[model samples]
Target: MTIQAAFTLIINTLGPLQGNREAANIAHIVIEHITGMGRMDRVIYKDKLLSPAQEEQLQQALNALLKHEPVQYVTGKAWFYGLEFTVNRNVLIPRPETEELVEWIVKDTHTPVKILDIGTGSGAIPIALKKDLPAATVWSVDVSAGALEVASQNATQLNLNVHFEQIDILDTTATHSLPLFDIIVSNPPYICESEQKDMEEQVIAYEPRIALFVPDNDALLFYRQIGLLAKEKLVPGGLLYFEINEAFGKEVVALLEKQGFKNVILKQDLYTKDRMVRGEN
Candidate 1:
């Protein structure tokens, strides 16, 4: 069958499980990944049929989507801050809220600064920051080696210089002697365990659990620990930025304040819900 024909058929088949738009998007993603034939190419070659191997690969991709897998995980790539990064089950897919966090960091800095991104995942935050600042030293950390490998591959592919380490933030003593940074940022897992039921199936089911949930009661666990680390690691007057749960913005501000961070400010997302906090240590 022709590429357009396959797209329509696959969308129709998967539309019932998810929404029509999501199904159609998945179809297009599968087509592009399987055949390396983008939307424009398919439009230009509307009369052409998929080769037999291409047809089989597209079918497999559709099957994976039908199982409720995320398109990013299925294709092993996601776009963040206008750049493409490799993604998989090993890490959380970068979110729009985190983009705002990066923006805040970029805007707050005055000169060449050293930046440390905790729980870097696909290295989206550091990579975007480096791409924007060009002169800053960007360092990133993640506990999962699998996630770090994907992040390293993305850095190489994007031709951006980023220093990545597989060190757990909770194990900060192992990483002593690192240079004091000018800015410290994180979009660490802030989702309380109780909030899992409300998340979309594609996220809860397909994204890495290690990168999503905190304890049920101590939702501020990462913020608190990172705040302490920031106290020890950040130079006086250095900035610390976080992408927080809208539900816990006030709580995060309080945590930072308790840790002696000053000028704590909470900023709302595009939806006007409290989504980010920045303070100085």
Candidate 2:
């Protein structure tokens, strides 16, 4: 099959499910990853024929997309904060909004500081911070050993030194012995279970639920626990950053304040959603 033919097939198959623009983007990404052809190559070689193996691979990727699988998971890779990281069903795919959280942390501190990321998932936040702040000592904690494994691999592949630990922050006893940090950041599971119906099928069905959701009655479960832990773990006048549920920004800010954190502030993402909160110890 010709490159254009395969491309058209991919669009026709996934366009209705993912919308035309996104389907086209996923098609290009799949093609680029598989063939390793640059964007210009897709334009110049539109009519070029794909070998039998290339056609088969493209078809397989298209099949996954047709099932509403995220392209990042289908390709086993995700881009975040100007770097690529490996991803799978075990980890939540990194989002652009989280990049804003990382950027905020990077901009807030200039000198060497100890940093810890709660519910690290794919290790995107810590890895990006370490890359930009090489002198910072970064540590990441997650409950799932599988997720920690993926995060650890990403740290190694990115050549960023970050310590990974499997610990459930919800169990305060588990984190009692962990060392204090200069800055603590988390993009924890803030999505309430009731909100799952409103999410994309691809995310709810494929992404790791433990990393994406909280009980409706306890929407701030992770944030609440992390906030408490930060109270004990942060140095005097240290910083706490959270990529919060937009709906609960004020609540999260309040939670931190109640924990004795001061200078609490809420910030919006590029989309202008109240998606981040910061506080000082």
Candidate 3:
């Protein structure tokens, strides 16, 4: 089949699943992955023919997209900040909002600081921070060994030195051995169970639920636990950052303040939702 023909098939098949523009983008990405052709090369070869094997691979990708699987999972790669990281069912796909959280950290602090990232799925936080702040001592911890494996691979591939450890932040006992930090950041599981209905099927079905949710009655579970831990682990004047649920931004800020954190502040993302919070020890 010709490249044009296969591209048409992909768009027509996946347009209903994603919008037309996104469908076209995914189709181009799949073709690029198969052909190894750059963007301009693909455009110039739009009329070129594809081998039987190439057609089969594109068909399989189309089938997965039709099933509501995320394209990052389909491709096993996701772009965050300025780098691409490997992703799988074990970790949550890094989102642009979380990149903003990383940018805030990079912007607020100078180098030669100790940093800890809680729930470091895909190691996006620590990896990005380490890349931008080359002198910072960065460490990340997660509960899932599988997720840590992916994070470790990403750290090695990016050639960034980030310490990885397995710790369940919700269990305070497990964090007692952790060292003090000049900055602590987390984009932990802040979504409540009741909010599951509002999430897209691709996320709810394919992404790790352990990285996305908290009990409905205990919506602030991670925030509460991590906040308390920060009070002890953060050095004097240390900073704590969180990408919080918009619904509970004020509540999270209040929780940190009640634990003796000062200068508690809630910030909105590009969408104007209260999505990030910061406090100082």
Candidate 4:
């Protein structure tokens, strides 16, 4: 089938499930991924026929998408902070708000400094930070061995030296061996179990649940642990950053303050939702 024909089929088939705008966006992403042709190139080859192999690949991807699998996982790649990284069901897909948090750290950082990232899913946080701030020594830790594997592969592919370790941050004793850091950053699992219903079906069905949720009654679990640990791991004047749930921005800020963090700031993302927070040790 011609590229144009296949593209329309994808849009029409998915339009009923996903909204028209989102279906079209997914169509564009899948088309580019399969054909390796950017927007202008795809337009130039609109009438180009997809080879048999390409057709089969398209069908497989469509089936997965019909099941609400994320397009990034479907393509095995996701872009963050201008770099493409491998992704799978083992890790959560990177999002734009996290990029803003990274930018916040990079803006405050200069010279060689020790940095640690908690919950290193896809290693996107540390990898992007390392790419931008080459002088910083970055280390990342996650509880899931599968997640660490994916993060390590990304760091290697990006040709960035980031130390990856397996540690459950929830276990305070497991972090004792970690060295002190000038900056500690985390985009921990802040969504309450009750909030899962509000999230997209693709996210709930295909994304790693361990990386996305916390018990509803203990929604601040990661933030509180990471904050307390940051107090121990961060050098004096070191900064701790988090991407928080909008519903509990004030609560997170209060939690950091209670942890003895000074100059705590609760910042909002582009959408003006309270999404990012930072505190000084």
TM-score list, all predictions: 0.97, 0.97, 0.97, 0.98
Candidate 4 lDDT score at position 134: 92
Local lDDT at 227 for model 4: 92
Q: How do all the candidates rank in terms of lDDT, highest first?
A: 4, 3, 2, 1
Note the residue pairs that clash in candidate 1: none
Candidate 3 per-residue lDDT, tens place, 1-281, comes to 87778888888888876778998998887887778787788779888989889888888888898899998998888899989899999999999999899999999987589999999989999999999999999999999999999999999999999999999998888999999999999999989999989889999999999999999999999998999899999999999999999999999988999999999989999999999999999
lDDT of 1 by residue, 1-281 (tens): 89788888888999898778978887888878876888999889866898999888777787787788888888888889999999988888888777887787878877999999999888999999999999999999999999899889999999999999888888768668567999999989988898988989888888888888999878998999899889988998999999988999899999899889999999998889899999998
Worst 10 residues of 2 by lDDT: 1-10
- Model 3, which residues run further than 4 Å from truth? none
Which parts of model 2 have CA positions greater than 4 angstroms off?
none
Clashing pairs in 4: none
Q: What's the C-alpha lDDT at position 50 in model 2?
A: 88
Local lDDT at 17 for model 4: 90
- Let me know the TM-score candidate 3 reaches against the reference structure: 0.97
Top candidate (lDDT)? 4
Expressed as tens digits, the lDDT of each residue in 209-272 for candidate 2 is 9988889998988888888888899999999999988999889888888889999999999999
